[model samples]
Target: MADKSNAESIITETQKRISNAFDVFDHESNKTVDVREIGTIIRSLGCFPSEAELHDIIAELEDEEPTGFVRYEKFLPTMTKILLERKFRPITEDLLLQAFEVLDQQKKGHLEPEELTKYLTQEGEPFTQEEIDEMLSAAVDPDKNVILYKDFVSMMTFDDTR
Candidate 1:
């Protein structure tokens, strides 16, 4: 079903991100990143966890040496799961509708292309123009030249990786 493919896509995306993050943060290329590197990685993602919170996160990971280092191969899945659940879990229909309402300032019941672009490129983790274009290409209704709330929600939730 669509849900199964979506889950697979999510897993695949998470794994790719995790691998890239590990490569970026593992400065020494030791196949592991230290606790400090871990904190830096988290901060790079626009999240700032307290020292205690960071410690708790590392504690949850099973480390062979307990040296405050995360081995990419050993901990990638856990890291991906944590990132997906904490930051990228699927949005609920009600939440999506409410967000659409907020964005649809004129209560037009749909978003014009410009409005959608603005929303996508808003401050804090802004999307690139290419990304916005790709999203619009997928979500926009060809006949309407706009994105209805339902279509937007479905596009946002749909994952094609079966």
Candidate 2:
């Protein structure tokens, strides 16, 4: 089944990344780590779990003892599920480009910094000025005439490990 295949693939890839991350915390390679390090291990794998999720994980591990070692194997299944359920996955270039296209009134492939800033901060979940500044710094063309949106979107969505 297609649904089953998707789950299997996601589990397989997440397992590999999680294993790499767990190995870093399991310094002794014992496949076990302190419950305190659970949050660090999840973040190291690039999954941005919320404080509530992190607390839940720590609590789950603390069930047998207030603070104790957690078998990495016990976490592989749980981590894969968390990864699948995470909402803040990386954005795609196509979606970004489509948004830009709507803003490009004149059908220009680029946008002025001011125009881009207004839409970014005034619409949707308004981005902070600092976040806009950081994004624009690498996104703007050298001449500073306009933002090549295609290039900008690509830079934002890039993930080497993918």
Candidate 3:
């Protein structure tokens, strides 16, 4: 019974977040948004579904009416499932550390700023110069001029913004 209630709570909370994300695109104050904005809304809620996944979602939602509008009410259940069951979340701290390890050829458990910047700006999902600088600024050990990747991973994966 407790598990069931907890699941319900999760569903409710997920729905609330989806609604809030949808609200951002509901400029007319109506509870509907353009079908095209579905992907944007889902991304805003922190779930980066792949292109194929997004296409499937849009196709399913468009099955009812070709109105090109998504009703938050109709979307709530799907959004909740996506939030609760989706696999593509921010990488785990350990995983992030492993990625950093690849750049740390010495296996020293840290990275020099220049090396990290080069990898971050030239590798898969490359960051812009500005992004690399911002992240390095926060994670760099000023005294050592290196990034303690373990600590950086911790901050990236678990920092409390509030």
Candidate 4:
């Protein structure tokens, strides 16, 4: 029963995250976004990757269909499985601090919206203005454009139980 509940929780979380990604993609472009966009979207959700790294994601999607525009249904399980498998670097407190280091362009101890956007793009993870704003609102300090170490840590740490 516990295992079933855990699976259900993971599925629900995956659905929420993927839904957010779809909204982010739609916000990024008025027209249809392709499967290649998945890498960028996932990265924007705070994953980092180089050009080569992103290509792997695109390649995986391409294997499913040539057009590369991964519909929401396709993206959810792919990403969820990736998360469950611990494929990418683990989301740890240390990693969260590193993300701030990457995002804090001004070195001002905080991350402004522009800085975060640039950082995300630099990491090859493109984000919509709305998505950037949302992430900032959730975790960043509006006054300083930086998130506190604790807040950043909290954002990345998963309870697994919840």
Report lDDT (CA) for all predictions. Answer: 0.72, 0.78, 0.79, 0.65
Model 1 TM-score is 0.47
- Candidate 3 residue spans exceeding 4 A from truth: 1-10, 20-78, 158-162
Among the numbered candidates, top lDDT falls to: 3
What TM-score would every model get versus the actual structure? 0.47, 0.55, 0.60, 0.47
Local accuracy of candidate 2 as per-residue lDDT tens digits, 23-135: 88896789888877887787766665566767887776554666487787778877877776764354566877898899999998999999989998888778888879987
**Which residue pairs collide in model 1, if any?**
none
Q: What ordering of candidates by lDDT runs from best to worst?
A: 3, 2, 1, 4
List where candidate 4 sits over 4 angstroms from the true fold: 27-32, 63-65, 90-162
Question: Model 4, residue 111: what's the lDDT?
Answer: 55
Better of 1 and 2 by lDDT: 2
- Report the lDDT tens digits of candidate 3 across residue range 11-128: 8877778888888999889888999899888777776666678888877766465798888777787777777786446566777787888878899988888888887778676787
Pairs that collide, model 4: 34-69, 35-68, 35-69, 35-70, 110-145, 110-146, 111-145, 111-146
* lDDT tens readout by residue for model 4, 1-162: 999999999778876876776677764454345765676677655555566777777676554547646555556677777666655543667767777776565666655556666776676657667777777777776567656646667775754432
Backbone clash count for every predicted candidate, in the order shown: 0, 0, 0, 8
Greater lDDT among 2 and 3 belongs to: 3
Better of 1 and 3 by lDDT: 3
How well does model 4 score by local distance difference test?
0.65
Query: Could you tell me the lDDT of residue 94 within candidate 4?
Result: 71
By TM-score, how accurate is candidate 2?
0.55
How well does model 2 score by local distance difference test?
Answer: 0.78
Model 1, position 160: C-alpha lDDT score = 25
